[model samples]
Target chain A: MKILVCVKRVPDPETVIKLTPEGASIVTDNVKWVINPFDEIAIEEALRIKEKAAGTEVVLLSIGQKTAQEQLRTGLAMGADRAILVLTDQVVEPLAVARVIEKLVGTEKPELILMGKQAIDDDSNCAGQMVAELLGWPQATFASKVVLGGDQKGAQVTREVDGGLETLAIPLPAVVTADLRLNEPRYASLPGIMKARKKELKEIPLAELGVDVAPRTRIVKLETPPKRTGGRKVGSVQELVQVLHDEAKVI
Target chain B: MIEWSEQHELIRQTFRRFVEAEIKPNLRELEHGDTPPYAILRKLMATFGIDQVARARFERQIAREKEGEAGPGERAAGPEAADSAAMQLIPVIELCRYCPGMVTALGVSVGLTAAAIMSRGTLRQKERWALPLLTLETIGAWAITEPGSGSDAFGGMKSTARRDGDGGYVLNGSKTFITNGPYADTIVFICKLDEGNEPRERKVLTFVLDKDLPGLTRSRPMLKMGLHSSPTGELFLEDVRVGRERLLGETEDVPARAGAKQTFSQERAGVPAMALGIVSQCLELSVDYARTRVQFGRPIGEFQLIQLKLARMEVARMNLQNLIFRQIEMAGAGKRMTLAEASAAKLYAAQTAMDVALEAVQLFGGNGYMAEFQVEQLCRDAKVLQIYAGTDEIQVSQIARSLLRG
Candidate 1:
């Protein structure tokens, strides 16, 4: 079985985030890049699947600027066998990335594609589902448990929903998006890191993948949510209940 | 106190996982039952490379030269350069001191097993036998002890080796309480060369015997009180005829007088590092347990009693760690100690390990005495520290004797 896991490169979680002067993007002048925390869980899942079920290969797929190559290398160091860097200097939106990955999946013909539900940096939880739609494949989003189906062409995915947890038996050629509760990602050892430098990394440009860089949503401004002010307190429970019912109107 | 560089941190994490998965869980059953953790211990042999010592030695040599402490462009270690050997032994000592069983298994499996081939075997012998010992393909036993040969390991050795027809040697020996002897594929059997001569000077001969060789017999595992995971057993080398290729150090009559001098010097160097490792292990066990275990109102770690124990453990640990390193450096730099100095470090560190481990158990109280607790295992394991690699009494004797000679 061939599995393609889409990974993202994001600023290290240790680095505090701050907005730029225009407030449209982040101020990432000098911050360490790491595989997104959620993506790490996705990578671990792919590796575990390949380990438990024999004759499987995990190919890391990442889309961003050139630094995405470094992120892909990080995945390779953590035991991914192969990597594909989808190149684009343009601010590639989630739908565009999803389309690109879908195109790559069509070329590779992987049995399953796994990715994080969303990148922590952008908080755009749309790529995995969009790719599933583009390829007309079943998607298991926010997946915490994945058991291979008896038929080999399907899987039972357990994930969270609005009110409670749910399970979905999705057929093969499926896309899986991970949540935080999957598995802890292992750090790459020195030997693994050294070997990663010699791994098979194939870089396919955005134009080569034949997906156009198109943004469906444009943010004119980015601002913090307004803060709530202090509320007045009443002397007793009865008085507080009356105030809540009357002035506060929260009863 | 244990700080990992960014590069080593990854390896540390891997090793930590390895310990959790392989060592920590089974440490209880293995220690109590005296069942040697042969499989996992052997598996961990892959992690530490054989030439790590040589590499460390090389790095230390270069560092010292660059600092201009030694003469210009001098590659050879001189009398003034005894510090490098000890420095080279630092990592090994630190690693083993954390876990004595780990080092003992490694030493016997690799260090002792390679003894015969390294000391006297021919080029053919070394190339073939040495490789297996180095990679842990065959565990090796350095057979030196007899029922009565505790302190006088060589002086009282009862095992005998007689040269048989044409190029074969027949060795008859019963080596007791041999480390790795129960499981060793190769045995470096130390025997009496001539029964009539003075026992101390001309009687000893070290021979390498293969376990598969005929007439060789071994007892089942001996129940040990501590360091229980280290395989110990009685070995009966009953007229075992090993080929000429198996003999170590010197082929012709062993030249016992010369080899004894060299072996004692090497043993002196080796024992100190082993002692350092023991103390280091004790310190780690104490500190880690203190931090996690709670007492009245707060972590016992916050209490002055626990703090004092930890502080003393650290002091002992750091002192021995450096002392051993200096000894190694001294050996590497070609300034072998006058016997007394070597025994002093070993004596101090070994006693320190016993003391520290005892205090660690005290800190753990009732939990420390339990078989399940790590501190109890360590406490049991610490007993051997006082006994082996030269007993404390033997060390005191050697040092005092050496002082008299001075």
Candidate 2:
């Protein structure tokens, strides 16, 4: 079985982002980049599948610039068979990314496609579903648990719902979007990191894939959230109740 | 300009994540409670395939030794060797950032004890003892420091191995400040060879000892000023009998003096990593504390004195990191530091770490003095760097002696 996982490079969630002078985007200089948390879960699930089935090849695919090679190498280090980088510096929208992935799917012909439900940077949970729609394959999004059937003919995916889980059995050649509880990712060992450099990482431009790589949406303005102000203390319970009822008006 | 390659950076990140997940939660237990660090260290080795790597390296080393192409003290001649060494040291530095004691405990077992056997022991001895220590399957202790001996380890040494009748030896000694001494399954016991020689001129003979040997007594862990996570204890060998097989190299001709000195140098070289960890952590904590901690209606970081402390810490960290980088480069080039150079590095690193840790504590002010703050633990741990391996005074002497000779 061959499993292809699509990962993305984003600024670490822990980084204190700063806006550019023009307020268009974040200041990228000196910002540390890491694999999207959800994507890491996707990669972990792929690795788990590979572990269960012998000779199961796990390939990682990413769509970004040359620096994205770092995240690709990280995937390889986590025991991916190889990597494919859909090289582009342009900011591709969800639909364009899905199209690029569709092209790769045609060429690679993987039995399964796994990716994060959403990238943390944009929180756009559309790529996996859109790609599955484009390929006309079944998809299980928000997957917390994925169990392959006894005969390896299908998978039972448990999706994390509002207050419970929703399980669905998806046939082969399916796309699964990993949710937060999918699985905990394993660390890349020192030896694995060193050996990752020797693994195959093939890069191809978006043009070569023959996909319409145009953004369908434009980001109008980027701004940080309003600064949080310190709370004030009330003298007594009566005063606190009065303040809550009048000023806050919640009570 | 010590820059980590992408690979090295990735490895550091991996280790940092592992430490946070595996080691951080148990910080209190490991530091204050009776939790031994071996199990966690073993898990780390297994997680990173360190045991497999060590096994492969050992097999190759043994093969080279058999061919007589690589003898004891002979380093593998290559850049890869240095790169591999640097890779191995990365974890040490990372671990030290939070728990320096764990690194101390691990280094003693794998770095010092296993190395002692592999460098001087026969093939049978290596297979019997060194392999297990290297894999961390069985804890090992390199017992050299005695109650009577510290700086003058060989000269002031009172421990001795006497030539008993019928070719066996009777070992009698007491070793203090021995890392993993209490729980060591295997021990490399260094003592004077009683060949009826002058007290000051006895030959240093090293013997391989196992726990539960007749008349062997291992003490409980002693109270220490720092490095609480690493158990330090005492060992007493009262007329312990051992056959010729237990003797390192199976002969007295291979002087233990040279080998012990080499071990000291190796220990000295490793201090930079430990020191780097301590300094890096201290600086990080102090900076964060300065930014958030409010005093006089503003962040303490705005104060010039606190900024100066943080700045000096950064300087120390950079210097220590550069020292490690230089060591790595030389290691990659198949070169080892001279004893004098190792001493110089250790002295500077140890002093810098101690100073930085104290400054961090000062920056934290009263909170730093309290054990609740992590900086307090760091301060305690950093002081040991200057005391162990070789004390600051001893290092100064070693450096000065070399210069005088030159």
lDDT (Cα, tens digit) per residue for candidate 1, span A110-154: 999989989988899999999999999999999888898655789
| 10 residues in a row with least lDDT, candidate 1 chain A | A186-195
lDDT of 2: 0.91
For every prediction, compared with the true complex, DockQ reads 0.08, 0.67
| lDDT of each residue in B208-229, candidate 1, tens digit only | 6778888999888788777776
Question: What does candidate 2's lDDT look like per residue over A109-174, in tens digits?
Answer: 998999999999989899999999999999999999999986778999999999998999999899
Q: Best candidate per lDDT, number?
A: 2
lDDT of 2 by residue, B1-406 (tens): 2687888888888899899889999999999847999899999999988898899888988898889876666776676776798788899999999999999999999999999999889999999999999999999999999998988888889899999987889999899999999999999999998888897888889999999899999999999888899999999989999999999999988868999998999999999999999999998888889999998999999999888998888988889989988988888777889999999999999999889999888888899998878888988999998899999999999999999998
Interface RMSD of 1: 6.5
Of the candidates shown, which would achieve the greatest TM-score relative to the real structure?
2
